[model samples]
Target: MIALPPELLPQLGEGLWHLFTVFLRVSAMVSLLPAFGERSIPTRVRFGIAVAFTMIVTPAVPALFAQPNLLAMVRLVLTEVLIGMALGLSLRLFVLALQTTGSIAAQATSLSQILGPAAADPVPAMGHLLTLAGLTVAVLLGLHVRVAQFLIHSYTFFPIGTAPLAQGLSQWGVQQIARSFGLAFALAMPFVIASLIYNLALGVINRAMPQLMVAFVGAPAITFAGLFLLFAGAPLILSVWSDALITFILNPLEPPR
Candidate 1:
C-alpha cells in the first residue's frame, strides 16, 4: 500500500477541496454549454467534458481559500453555480438566435411545417438545418479552444464566491435577449422581402385573371423561391452569425451595435 507523509495530508485535503469547488462551477456551465451541453449528448459524455474543462481551468484560476464554516461553503457553491450558469446562458443565446432566424425564414417562405417533427426541439426543417450548420461551423472554427479561454477569463469577470449585482445582471440579460431577436430578424430579412414581393405579384395576377387558380400557382412559386434563397443565402447568414457569436464571447458586456 502507498502512504503519504502525515504533514502532506492537510495540503492534499486543501487541494482536493479547491478542485471540488472549481468542478462545481465548471459542471454547471458545461450542462448548458453549446456542443458539449446539447440535449442529444449523453449525460456521461457531458460529465466527462466538464471534468476535462475543470482540469484546464483549475490551474489557470487562483485556488479558493479553505472555507471556515458549513454556511460559507454552501454560499460558495451557490454563488459559483450562479455565475457559471450566467456565462453558459450568455453563449447559448447565440444558438437560440440561429434557431429563431430559421423559424422566421421558414414561416415567411411557407416552409415552416416541413419535417417539423424530426428535430429534438420540434423546430422547422430550416431551423434544424441552420442550428446544425451553425454548430458545425462553430466547432470547425476551434470553438473548444475559445470556450476554454472564455471559462478561464470568467473568473476575472466574476470573482470566486461572489454573486453579480442583481440590477446589472438583469439589465445585461435584457440586452442579450433583445440582441438575439434583432439578429434573428436581421438574418431572416431576405426571406421576408421575398415573401412580400411574391404576395404582391400574386395579388396583381389574381386581380387580372379572376377566374384562374392563383393560389396553386403562387404556392409552388414561393416554395421554389424560398428554397433557392436558402441555398444561396445560408453561407452569408452563417458568416454573420459566427461573427456575432465570437464578438459576444470576447466581450459579453459590450452593448449591441
Candidate 2:
C-alpha cells in the first residue's frame, strides 16, 4: 500500500471546514423557504437538499473559500449564514403577506375553522392555499434560476465574511419588510372586497327576516362564495405574486441602484 502525504492533511481539513461553512449558510436559507422549510417537509430531506445545494454552490464562489486563519474562517462562516438567512427570510416575508390575506379572507368567508400547515406557523385553510399558490407561482416563473442568481450576486454586495449585522440590517431591511405588506394587502384586495359585498347582502337579508337563522345560512353561503372567488381569481392572484417574488429576490440586499 502507498503511504499518504502527511502535510496534505491540514490543507484538506481547511477545505472541509470551508465547505462545512458553505453548507451551513445554504442550509439556513433553505430552512426558511416556503415549502422547503414547512413542517410537513421532513428534516432529513431538507438536510439532504441543503447539502446538495451547497455542493453545487461552493465551487462557483471560490472567493468565499479562500484560505484564512481559524478565527477568520469562523467569522466568514457566520457571516454567510446570517446573510443567507436574511435573504431567504426577506423572500419568505412576501409569503406571509399572502398568509395574512388568507387569514382575513377565511374569516370574512366564515371558513377560518379549516386549517393546515404552511410554514413554521399553522395557518387557516385559505391561508394555506394562498401560500401554496404563491410558491407555485414562484416555481412556474423560474424561481430556481432566480434563487441561484440571487445567491451568486450576494458575494458582491455582502462578500463572504463581512455581512452587516444589527445596525446595518435595520437600515437596509425595513423598507423591504414594509413593501412586502403592501404587496400582500393588494393581492388580497379582490377577495376582501368580495367578502364585504357578500356580508352587506347578508346583513340586508337578516334585517328583513328576523325569524330566519342567518348563522347557518350565512356560513355556507360565504364559504361557497369565497371558494368560487378563489377559483376565479387564482390565476390573477398568482400573476401578481410572481411579479412580487421576482422583485423580492432580485434586490434582496442593497437598495436597488
Candidate 3:
C-alpha cells in the first residue's frame, strides 16, 4: 500500500465523499431509470450501472464541499433520494404512457384478452408489445447519453442538500400524470376511431338482416382489423411516443401543449 502525504489525504477524502454523495443520488435514480431499472435486470447489474453513471455525472456537477454532521448526513440522504426518485419517476411516466396507449388500443380493438398473460406485468399483449418496443427505440436513440445529461442538468434545478417545495412538487406530479394520460389517448385515437366505426357498421348490418348472426361476422372482422392496424400504425405510434419522451428529457417541467 502506498502512503499518501497529509496534504493529499484531505483532498482524497473530499473526493471520496463527493463520489459517495453523487452515488447516493445516482443509485436512487437508477432504481427507476428506463432500461437500466427494469425488474428483469439483476440488482448487482443495476448497482454497477449506478456506479458507472456516477462516474460520468460527477465530473459535470459541482462538488458539495460542506461537511455534514450526523443529522445533516441523514437529511442529505433523504433529500438526494427524494430528488433522484422524482427525476426517475418523471422519466418512467413516458414508459407508462406507452403501456397505457397499448392498453387503450387493445381494449378498443377487442384484442385485450389475447395473450394478456404473456408479460410479467398484468398488462395486455398490446401493452407488452408497445412497452417493449418503446423501450427498445429509446435505448437505440441514445437514451443512456440523454440520461447522463439529464442527471447532470438536474443538479441545476435541484441542488445538493436541498429539498423541492412540496406544493410545487405536487403540482408538477399532477401535470405529468395528466400529460401522460392525454398522450396515451392521443396515440390510441386511431384504434378507438376504428372500433367506433366497426361497432356502428355491425349494428346497422344486424338491423338490416335480423336473421343473420352479426356477432360472429363482426368478431373476426374486428380482430383482423386490429391486427392489421397494429402492423401498419406501430411505426407512427412509436415515432410519436419517442418524440414525446425526448421532449420530456429535454425539458421535464414544461407544461403539456
TM-score of 1: 0.97
| List of clashing residue pairs for candidate 1 | none
What tens digits encode model 2's per-residue C-alpha lDDT throughout 61-142? 7543367788886777788788889877877887888888787777777777765554456778888887887887787777
Which regions of candidate 2 deviate over 4 angstroms? 1-17, 64-67, 115-120, 204-217, 253-257
Order of all candidates by lDDT, from best down to worst? 3, 1, 2
Better of 2 and 3 by TM-score: 3
| Residue 39 CA displacement from its true place in model 2, Å | 2.4
Judge candidate 1 against the unseen true structure and give its global Cα lDDT, from 0 to 1. 0.90
Off by over 4 Å in 3: none
lDDT of 3 by residue, 1-257 (tens): 98878899878888998998899899999999988999999999999999999999999888877679999999999999999999999888888888898899999989999975777777889989999999999999999999999999899889998899999999999999899899999999999999999999999999999999999989999999999999999999999999999999899878988
The clash count of every prediction, one per candidate, is 0, 0, 0
TM-score of every candidate relative to the true structure:
0.97, 0.82, 0.98
List model 1 lDDT by residue over 121-163, tens digit each: 8788998899999999999999988998998888898878878
- Minimal lDDT window, size 10, model 3: 115-124
**What's the distance in Å from true for residue 164, model 3?**
0.2
